[model samples]
Structure formats: structure tokens, C-alpha cells
Target: MYHLPSSPTIRVLDRFSTLPDEYADDDQLVSFWPLLSAILLRPVSTTKDVVDALEEIAHVLRQSTGPAGDYGTLSKVLNALTFIDFPPGPHPGMTLRLSRSQAACLVAHQFLTSLASPRDRSEYYDFGIWYDSEQPHPRAAEMYITAMCVFFADLPDINILEEYATRDLEMGGGVSYVLASAPARSVGNTPMSPFRVLHNDVHVTGPHSPSSMDPNGALVVAANKVIGFGKSATGEEVTLGTTPEACPAVLVTPVLTGDQVVVITGASPVLRVTGERRNVAWEIPDTRTASADFDAWRMHRAGGPLLLMDALELDEHVSELGQVPDLVPENIEREVHKATTSFMATAATTVYTPLWGCGAFCGDPAVKMCLLWLAASMASVELVLLLDARGQALADELEPFVRRWQEKTAAELRQWLGRVPRTLRGGQVLAYIDT
Candidate 1:
């Protein structure tokens, strides 16, 4: 419930109140309030052109009822909007919990109030790309908004409107956010979490895949969910990474807890709403309209949560050095340790991730895999790596490689990371470490 005209002193919309003819219909009021509130907030700032455009849209909404769509659904959406408010402020270990309906409302709120978010934000910041993009995509913004309407609508055996009303009663029915803190650095030999591998997409969901991870309460790793910690836009839901699997998962994330993905030292917890495979599969190129198959696109809480973590950027460093990047550069080993340690702090016993920081970040997958395995070992959580085609070779070599170093303490591993040859890349680096 972030009211527009943030300050009471700025009565920019007072002139509209004096005009009697504008406030005639209640339906108009229902639809008009969101637009009006946005205008008063002046999210993009008080530029004349932007103000004029918003006023024009508001004027159109005020005069016309628009469509014969379900006002009942709209009412539920509005009610959810009222209940949905971001935490008062972000501090260490702050927690905000929302039911499935409230989570949908949070997504809706992000879309409706996207104007207030920064314009220069990366595409990961909001759903504008899905709706506002000229090319014929799934229209994710409209789909999410419509999905909220359907979810909140009065239906048999389902009371979504009442879901948020009794949030305490629901057991794992909604999303929960915990700004996780970095874990204490370990020096002794910590028992390693069980390790496994899956050669598939990180976003893939089915019985054949690891979808059963929901019941175990797992936390899947999203590659680079948000960047730019301070001085970045606090609002808008952005994608995490540019990868085909990771980018579209933003639809499930709905909204970010604070400005950056890594607001805390290590991990930013996000709820990856399960059962909405079609909506999140944006790269598949949907030919149907946004409103198509509304009944099938419900958000199920079965998939559990996703841990949004950003790997250390090593592309520039690797390019400049003209040799293969090792795990020790820029305290990259410490960065990986912080993320895995943060994951260990959460309820999830397992963490599924790909070769993070390997793509545009230019991190060597072999080096990254070794570092992640070492960190996960220290955290005592099961690590299931979702490897692509290129990573299968590393996956084969990783087991024996890790087994050889399994007896080493955390301090010994760090010492070993520093001693590895800088000239070696990929499996060669792992071979050097093994030696």
C-alpha cells in the first residue's frame, strides 16, 4: 500500500477533484485509482512529456468502462493490492512472507507501478519486456496480471481472496523472503553435502526431472538474478541472468525484496512459483494471446524456493590476463564461499545450480565447479549441478577430482587454490590441482 503523491504537501491532482463530471461511476473509480495514484507518484519524475502521457491514459480510463470483463476478478486484485506491501525497510535478516494470492498481487503491483521504477534498469528489473516488447512474445505482464485476476476470482473450492487473510494458517502455501546473512568461515573439515548431477535445463520441471525436490524444500540457484547493489532501482522485478534457462525464471520470482539481488552479503531468497511452466517459458515463442489458457496457468507452491546469488564477475580479468582464469582471482573463492554458506543458513538441504559465472562473466567452468563443490562441502548441503552440453566432460572429471581433495581442510583448499597454475585452463587447471 504505497500511496501515490508520496507527500501530502504535493497536491498536484487537486484540480481533478474540483471537476464534478469526472467522478461518476464506481467501476471507473475502481480502475481509475491505480492510474491516478501512479500519476501522483510521478515515478519517472515530473517531466512534462511523461506527465502529459500519464494524464492522457488516466483521462481515457476515467471516461470509458473499457471492456465487459469480470469486475469480480478486478475487485479481488484490488483487495490483494491493499494487503500487499513491501517490508518497511531492509535490514540484516529481514523476513517478509506472502501467500500465493498475495504473491500474485505483488507481481501485479510491480507491473501496475512499474512507472516509478528506474528507466535505465536492466531487463531483469521488470516484466515490461514481455508486455512492452514489439515482437510477439507471451505478453507476460498481461498474462501475470490476468493470472492474478483468475487466481483471485471467486471460484469453487478455492478462496484466493481469503488466502492472504489467514496467512498464518497456510503451511508452505505462499512465498517467504529471508535476507540471508553470510555464514562463519570454516577452517576444519566440514562433512560434505551429497553431490549429484543432472544434464538438463535449470528451469525444466517434470517427473522425469528433479521436480520432486519440492517436498524436500530445496533452493535452486538462479544465476545473477540482479546486479548493482547500491544506487540501483529498488522497485521492479528483473531477470537474474541472460541465459535461456535463468532469465525467464523472473516471472516466477515476481518481485525483488530490495533494490539489488544480493542486498545482503550473500543470498537473496525468492519464491519460484511452481506449476506455471508455460508462462515462464518465454524463450519458446508463444503464438497464443496473453489471455490464452487462463485456467491452466495457476501458480503452485510445490517447487519450493530459489536462492538468487550473483557470482563474482571475472570476464574482464580473464581477458586482460590472456590466460585461463583460476578460482583465486578477485577473492572469487571467498565470494563462492559466502554464497554457499548463505544457502546453508536457509531451510533447504539441497542446492541445484549450473556452471554459474561461466558465460558472459567469463569464469572457467572447471574452476567454478571446483570452488562450488568445495563450498558446498563446507556447507554440508546436497549439491545437484545442472550441467549443459559443454559441462558434461567436467562433470565426469569432477568426481575423482573432488575425491582426491576430499580429505583437505577448508584452509588447505584455499592454500591449494592459490598454488594452482595461472596458465592452465579448464580440465588442465583441475589436473594441475589434482597433481
Candidate 2:
């Protein structure tokens, strides 16, 4: 049985083609819009109805398939939408279906992902912010994508839609980093679990490997321009003039060298933010992280199932303290949007991060705190702003910030969601499989 509710509200829009002309043209979307509108108009909806509509959408896409790349993009869109809420019972019209921003985001997210070859990604770099010309604003793009994600990302409580993201992210593959991680069961156990944050979802923490500390969950870290990788110790320079071979899917994203949002899918690490390739690309062979900055995003890494986010821009010159490079409010907003967005995604159950900019990067922890606090504030995930090597000194430095984060930590806000293993009610299994 489904749990209780907050408040039931419903609204219906009669039109489907309400989106403006600026959105990228997609023949399939053009035809499917009306059907989508009808689905939303239902006086009442069932979980089955939601899946049927998705099937219809996929059916149409299959008919208009362009190439292998097109299929891949379509697949990701489908996958991301795999976990959607139908609001069990008679509630209807609770969707972002008609928003032009959502449509534009759809097009932007899908555009080049299906291309057979790499092309200039500058055109789609920035979405949401309408430009006089086609040139993009990375910051705008990050914000737009994050905003649109709320429409169908993860949600509180259990629903078929919400579970799909969890299923694909942890059990199989979807738009997440688990697929890019090492085998689920490396020590000869059953298959390893997929990367996801199933419970106690919130945000906070210090710099470290994105997936190492709590392999069961997800982490976010900085990257460096230098080609080498480091261990658990993040925010350092580890350039070794080496590069991982690019996977075919890297072409879908418009990544450039030293740009942020390069995701690793259990193998080689490739840039996923800009279209150009770096002379030397960074890779964390053992799942370590490095230094970089951001426009905030989660992009698919080539070769593996993990999607990397090249959010940080690398400060080329190492500083006396460290390369902290220039900081921008937009940069903070972009990354915060990501943390918030990922928090919404089922993949981020327990959000952890470090004192970002305070390392060799030389950024003021105070400035970083404002942005981080904004992210933690907006997120539903459990955030733990860790007191690592800095210890009491750093804690003393940001006493107010620490207190603020603590105040936010309550049972309703954050708690320990211990997983209780399951067993057969009948007792021990003394039988054998016939498979």
C-alpha cells in the first residue's frame, strides 16, 4: 500500500504545442507532443498508464530512428524518464510536459548524443538562457538541465517511477556513475550493487574521491589539468602526461581539454564537457579524484556506464598555496544546482563533499561555504560537511557554518537509514537451484 500524502493538487493544460520556436527541432517529439498531452489530461491515472505512454514514445522514436547515435540519445532520454511519478490514484496533469524549457532541455540533452562523429559542441553548450546567436553559456546550460530534471528525477517515497532510477542506477544501468565503477562483486561475492544513495539522502562534506569513501553511495570531487590521477586524497595535482582512450559515446558531449564534467565509467576517463580533447586527459585508475572547477553537470563517460560531471575548470598555474583559480557566483550556483539535482536523483542518498577551494586551490572557505550551504539547503539528501585533515582549526574557522549545517540536521532533515538485510521467513535455505 502507498503511504500518506502532503496535499493533493492537480491542474491540466489543454495545449501540447505551447512550446516556442527556439527549441531544437525533433521530428519525433513534434509528433508525440499531442499524445503526451492526452496522457496528462486523464481525469485519473495508473502506474500502467505511465509506462504505456513511455512505450508509445519509444515506439515513435524507433520509427524515426536516424542512426546508432540517435538511438543512444533516445535511449538515455528514455532511461532518465524510466522512473517517473504517476501520483497513484486520480491525480493528473502533474507534469513538466508542456514547458518549452523542458522541451529545449530535451533537445539539448539529446542533440549530439546520437551523432556518428564529433562536431562543434559550442552551439549547445549553454541552454535556458536565450542567446542572440547560437553560442552557448555553460552556466545557463547547467541551470536549465538541473531545473528540468526536477520534473522527472527522483522523489520522496516509493513509486514505480522513482524506483526505476534506483533500479537502473543500482541494479543495472541508467544515467548514473555506478555503471562506470568497478565490478559490483570483485571479491567473488554476488554481483556488486550499483551506485546509488537509497536512504538518508542529504548533502554536505569535504573533498575526496567521488565514489570511494562510501562506495555504496555517490561522491563529488574536483579534477586537475594534469593527466595523472590520485588516490583518496582529492584536490591535488596528479599530472603524468597520460590519457585514456576515448570511448565512442564521448562524441555525444561537447567536451574540451581541462574542462569540467568528465565522468569515468569503470575504465578510462574522458572529457565530457567540451568537444575538444585535451593533449593530456586525467584518469583515476583506482577511483581517486583531482582538481578542476565547474558549470555543473553530469555527463556520460565514454566506454563505461558511469556519467562524469566536468564541473570544475582547472587553474593551469599551481599557486604557492595551490591553484584556486578565479571564482564566480555562477560557478557556485552551477555546482549547487548539480548537488541539488543529484540529491533529487536516487543516486545521491548520502551527499558528501569537502572544503572545496580551501586547498592548494587557495579559495576562501567562507565564499565556498555560501555556495555549499545554498546547495545543502536546497537538497533533500543528508549532507555531512566533513572535518577532515583541517580538524579543529578549520572547524573553528567556520564555526558559524558548521553550526548552520548542524541546525539543518534533524530526523526530518537527515538521519541514519540503516539497511536491514532480508531473509526467508521459513528459515535457512537448504535447497538447490534447478537452473
Q: Mind giving the per-residue lDDT tens digits that candidate 1 earns over 392-432? A: 68888887776777666655665667788777788787788
lDDT agreement with native, every candidate: 0.43, 0.30
Between which residue pairs do clashes occur in model 1?
124-238, 124-239, 125-237, 125-238, 126-237, 224-240, 225-240
Among these predictions, the greatest TM-score belongs to 1
- Quote model 1's TM-score: 0.60
CA deviation > 4 Å runs, candidate 2:
1-212, 224-252, 256-332, 357-362, 386-392, 408-435
- Candidate 2 lDDT over 114-139, as tens digits, reads 11122533222221122112212323
Clashes of 1: 7
- Once model 1 is optimally superposed onto the true structure by TM-score, how far is the C-alpha of residue 375 displaced, in angstroms? 1.5
